[model samples]
Target: MRTFLTLFIALTLGLGWGLAARAEGFLGVYEDLPLAPGLTEVEGSGLSFDSPGGRIVEGYATGAVEAAEILKFYAATLPQLGWARDSDTLYRREAEVLKIDTEVDGGALAVHFTISPE
Candidate 1:
């Protein structure tokens, strides 16, 4: 029983730390944007500082969250982060484009987000 308790505690703490570390990578321009609840960053699904002109981030997140909620969340939040919304796309005042699309992929939702300067 004591051994089981120790293992459980270690697993719990390790999981929390892993989540935090995963979130820490999305700093700078991505600071205002947030990952959907219960979603973790997919490996090799992100690109940062790719060029002098743009950056791209794309990946799938597995969660029970609804697609509409994810869209609504960004629709409302991006403007607050200084990205102007025009229909389904967002644009920065400096001509950067933030495109987002989501669809059901297997048991998870595939999220594609790309931002590029025009």
Candidate 2:
């Protein structure tokens, strides 16, 4: 009985740790910008800098997901993160604008994400 209880405690801690890590966002692309599931960041495709205006970030990710699904995901998700949908591919927050562009690359969909000062 003691051994079974110990095992359960260990599993519970492990599951909680996993969930916390997953909530930290994928790829570390941009803070508060959620990467859609099934997409992975492209190597050496991230750029970030701070200008007099504000910060700018650019990155790319690729996945096998459909374009419509990607769009739908962001439309539903971004607002929850304080981003307002300005258009089908653009979102605006307090002082920044995020632009998302996707294209078919080989057999995968490549997404380019850009965030700039508004």
Candidate 3:
């Protein structure tokens, strides 16, 4: 099953470092994406979402691009639809790395995420 995929930068900038970075649990076709504020996963398109979590566009990888670049893309596409940033959660571990969970106002399309080094 495809899981939340990370759009990495070590690979996006064409660094060719071949670092130990890898993409795992990258899922597509998110279903029942919550579009409301209180509820969750009501209705979603198998293709595009212009609501809250709807900002999550496919055909992109975090492990393949810089964080700044990924942010830029989201910034450009999200605001165009007036999707508001409800909250951004950060997950971290002891002596480990930091992971980020981005929440939006796509109603029930609640897309939660966190990333760590591999």
Decoy 2 TM-score against native: 0.77
TM-score of each: 0.61, 0.77, 0.25
- What does candidate 2's lDDT look like per residue over 9-100, in tens digits? 34534676322223224445565566776678887889889999999999898999898877877887667556799987999988999999
Model 1 Cα displacement at 72 (Å)?
0.4
Off by over 4 Å in 2: 1-24
lDDT of each: 0.55, 0.75, 0.29
Backbone Cα, N, C clashes tallied per candidate: 0, 0, 27
Give the top-scoring candidate (TM-score): 2
lDDT per residue for candidate 3 within 1-118, as digits (tens), equals: 1122122332322453322122222234432111212222223423434443223332212232334433433333323222333332332222222223333443322343322331
Error of 2 at 103 (Å): 0.2
